[model samples]
Target: MSAVYSVKEIYIYPIKSLAGISCQQAFAEEMGFENDRRWMLIDAENQFITQREHRILSQFYPQISDGKISITFQEQKHEFSAYEHLDNPVQVNVWDDKSEVVEVNESTSKWFSEQLGFECKLVKIIKPGDRKHESSRLKEIFNVSLADGYPYLMIGSQSLDSLNEKLADKITILRFRPNIVISTEVPHEEDDFTTFKIGDVQFKNVKPCGRCIMVNNDPENGKLKKEPLKTLSKYRVVNNSVLFGTNIVSLNSGIINVGDEIIF
Candidate 1:
């Protein structure tokens, strides 16, 4: 029998660059999955901070419960109201995109400052109009959350399995930090998928995600590694950039769950 392709895992990073929480199901939104990358950390200059610069960010763990989100770093834990709306708007930068975001609160910022050992503030995306994903291929612009670029990112399980086979040290899929993981026999098959569906929702596969130095930062040990990126560069290089998961944009909003069949 041909290998069955289905949604195996779902994840959401409520705060950009921090740890993600796995879920059995996720609500698809126009910008991204509900609560995915809705929050982010910015320095004193309002520039975004990520694992790319501070590997310790991988050590921060966030958990959602009882209408509140709690983030823990070492022995310190801070909780925030799940849907709290702070009206303090501030200009922030994410990559090349600059937009106005709502400053979460002083206490949240202080908590992060203590953890990262530097001055930083936590902010949330309150207005979708503040940011848009400019696409040369797509006729219409797409709204995005605080994610690097695209709204959704997907990787086939076999893709990681294939990469791990070539490395002396095996790495887990969490290193990839994808929102959606699909089970497939053929590695990198998602690269060819232009349009597909999960359950009843349609998605347009826009482009292959370019692997960055952030992937080198191991999520568990919070240390840099050279296996996967080193191996991927040897064979997966395209246009002088190493490529991995495929970025997707939702064409419709709906509920997607694990075990949902992926229709190409």
Candidate 2:
């Protein structure tokens, strides 16, 4: 029975470093959830840029409807196709892993670059698994999206609950940007789960997600704070890295819904 734990939340970031969209249910795929981290912003050098360096990136939120994505910055809004044209294929470096992606369009590219006050291109992966996972933590390699690494990230609700007890001002679960959140009696329980199932899809916990200063970014204001990470380092640090959630890879393609029991 898939009853030990249940899915509490599902989230997807259409563009890397941008605000995420919450969903009641999500499709599971080898690379990642559909439209999750499929698009990214790259500098002139073709190196991927993220909120880590420019926190304001989180202020731009994307919403998809009828195969189109719209992002509003300041007071202006622009829309682009979810799957941009494949004719403008380009090579990009997502932290060392090279992948082929397509430039969205001239209009959207100009809009974003003008708003961000920098010369950057909006790119989208034409297909799933465009970028292969490059991690020594796992023995086998699989495809991944524009996410830092891994296809999925799962965190227990209690983990944030426990962490909030130590924080002076608690942060939202969105701060962790997990693709899946399971309700569990214990904090960080997903860390020990090697193999599990959420709804109809089987998943494997491949590695512990090491957090960085990105966690310090305030989801609401796109401002940086010292709270969560500063407090987390005291108790969660291991091997010079502060660990929080578990990175996972789907075993098969299926549907994962909120309230779906998590079987371990």
Candidate 3:
């Protein structure tokens, strides 16, 4: 019998370095979702901070609805009403590059401060510039327009299952935090897919996704597990970075749905 492949899951992390939401369908863009990761929290010095340093952010819940983004933490909720205007400004560094972005303002900042028990501000990435993927295999400079890294991270459902089969304890797949999860034609076949298309959009494979300690942290309870990480370290090492999935830059913009057949 021939094998079958399809898209099995879709997820979007509305806030950078926070918990993500599982969706049945999502609009794909060159820079990721329409508004995903557009807003991030930066320190007083305008430096970017992520789960790599502050795991407390894993407890924050963020959602998008009706042109507004609402973030909830502890017992309080703060909503941002400005999606059209990019006026409130602050300087923030995505990595080493600093870009001026609109801060979410006092009302939103207060909620985060109380939740994380720290002084921090919400900033949005709106400035369009040349963002590139550093690959020795490429002959020309590969570029993108949004925040750091590629637009999407794709994983195979079977791939995770294969990994879990080797583990002593079963863990939820959300720990990986992938944007697209597809059921490839064969087991681990996604590892060979260079370019895939769904609807009218084509995505070019960029690089292997590097795993981190965040994968061990539960997105819901803000807790970490050691067994899974220890298991991955044995087989998932790549270029000194622990890799789990493939990062892709979109070749076109379109809506993608769960169960969509991806043509390679």
Q: Which stretches of candidate 3 lie over 4 Å from their true place?
A: 1-3, 82-89, 130-136, 139-148, 185-187
- Span of ten consecutive residues with least summed lDDT in model 3: 138-147
Cα-lDDT of candidate 2: 0.89
Question: What total of clashing residue pairs does each candidate reach?
Answer: 0, 0, 0
lDDT of each: 0.89, 0.89, 0.73
150-183, model 1: which lDDT tens digit per residue? 9899999999999989988899889989999999
How close to the true structure is residue 186 of candidate 3, measured as C-alpha lDDT? 48
The residue pairs that clash in candidate 3, if any, are none
Work out the TM-score per prediction: 0.96, 0.97, 0.89
After superposition, candidate 1 runs with Cα above 4 Å error: 1-3
**Alpha-carbon lDDT of model 1:** 0.89
| TM-score of decoy 1 | 0.96
- The per-residue C-alpha lDDT of model 1 at residue 166 equals 92
lDDT of 2 by residue, 1-264 (tens): 243788999999999999999999899999899999999998888889998999999899889899999998769899998866649679887877889998888788889899999999899887765788666877788889999988798999999999999988978998999999888888887888988887789999898899999999998999999979999999989899999999999989999999998777
Which ranges in model 2 have alpha carbons more than 4 Å from their true place? Answer: 1-3
Sorted by lDDT, highest first, which candidate order results? 1, 2, 3
